[model samples]
Target: MDSKIVQVALNGLENILRLGEQESKQNGMGINPYCALIEEAYGLDKIEFLQSHENQEIYQKAFDLIEHYFGVEDDDPSVVPQVDENQQQFVFQQQEAPMEGFQL
Candidate 1:
């Protein structure tokens, strides 16, 4: 609804992407499928630890960071974060779904 809110959402995605894969290795939280936890992780902001090392190519740690520290699990719905309406606008070329009876 606001720029700060939107920015926080975007930043949260990055933080989850950076942490969830790692958190799963420990705690044995059993890979939550509805990953609203990623958003929960954002509120915690522990992802700040990752900001300095983001450019490195070794993503395993980054993934582990996500999986473990940020409470991400492979089966978690958050693992496949949804593209919000604003994000969908930028990610795909839009063509409306065809109606069943209105074939072109």
Candidate 2:
């Protein structure tokens, strides 16, 4: 893909995410529909891949968009932890059968 087109796409996505975030805050909602939709559509993966583009500007814009909207930090723990909704505790270690004995 062209660098210019990629930059434009990233900018547009950033704008949409920003607006969605603002709307979510104003509505006192915990979920941002726009963000959720993007995630569901695997947009996050594409954004991450774009971060490695040859063009510095493209990569930087991708990085900035992710850092600003995703709230990811360099100091974050490496473990892929999941929350135990039932017990309200953090499960840091990976589970082979995380859903074992779990009930809706």
Candidate 3:
């Protein structure tokens, strides 16, 4: 896919995740389901890939997402976290139903 497209998708994902995190906290959920979705989708892989993107804005957005979710600095290689074919199917299964309310 085009880098711009990927960047836009990542930005949207980050926004949703950040918003979900805030709302979940307010609701006392203690965990962000959107973070789980990102994990299931191997979001860290995309972050790693985008780190080398020639576009500075893209890399910055990726880094910001990382920092927000992991509470880690950009130089922290340990926190950056993958999916496979079977896992892809499992992710799809989990996403089959749209979330109706604040329930995870």
Candidate 4:
């Protein structure tokens, strides 16, 4: 696979992760930028993450972040959470018909 694309994206993601670590510096030197620059180095680790293949871990991380940001989680059939009136619109719309076979 092409590596240049991976390098560019990893650089972008690293730059994002560096937003909070700007204060910690050692004589004006820090690992944040160094770590961020690893995107250009000859290695597959960063590439694999920034550019995931079919079974990449980065995909999972991305999904997790999405779920967290959306305040949603996988609904387990074995367990159900108590839903209040306000959440009915989100989980089950009051105007929508409930499935006949759905159990409480």
**Comparing 1 and 4 on TM-score, the stronger one:** 1
Among all candidates shown, the one with the greatest lDDT: 2
The lDDT of each candidate is 0.49, 0.85, 0.75, 0.47
Q: Is candidate 1 or candidate 2 better by lDDT?
A: 2
Segments of candidate 4 deviating more than 4 angstroms: 23-104
RMSD of each: 14.4, 9.1, 15.8, 14.1
Model 4, residue 36: distance off in Å is 17
- Sorting all predicted structures by lDDT, with the top scorer first, yields 2, 3, 1, 4
Worst 10 residues of 1 by lDDT: 51-60
Please give the lDDT score at residue 61 for candidate 4. 45
Off-target runs (Cα >4 Å) in candidate 3 are: 72-104
Choose the strongest candidate by TM-score.
Answer: 2
Poorest 10 consecutive residues by lDDT, candidate 3: 87-96
Each candidate: how many clashes? Answer: 20, 0, 0, 0
Superposed by TM-score, candidate 4 places the C-alpha of residue 92 at a distance from the truth, in angstroms, of: 54
Model 2, 7-65: lDDT tens per residue? Answer: 88988998899899899999999567797898899998999999889999998998887
Q: Can you write out model 4's per-residue Cα lDDT over 1-104, one digit (the tens) per residue?
A: 55555445544654554552463354465444443344457333534454355535545544443332223356985455455787574353345687687787
* Model 4: how far residue 69 lies from native, Å: 20
Give the per-residue Cα lDDT of candidate 2 at 63.
Answer: 89
Position 36, candidate 3: lDDT: 77
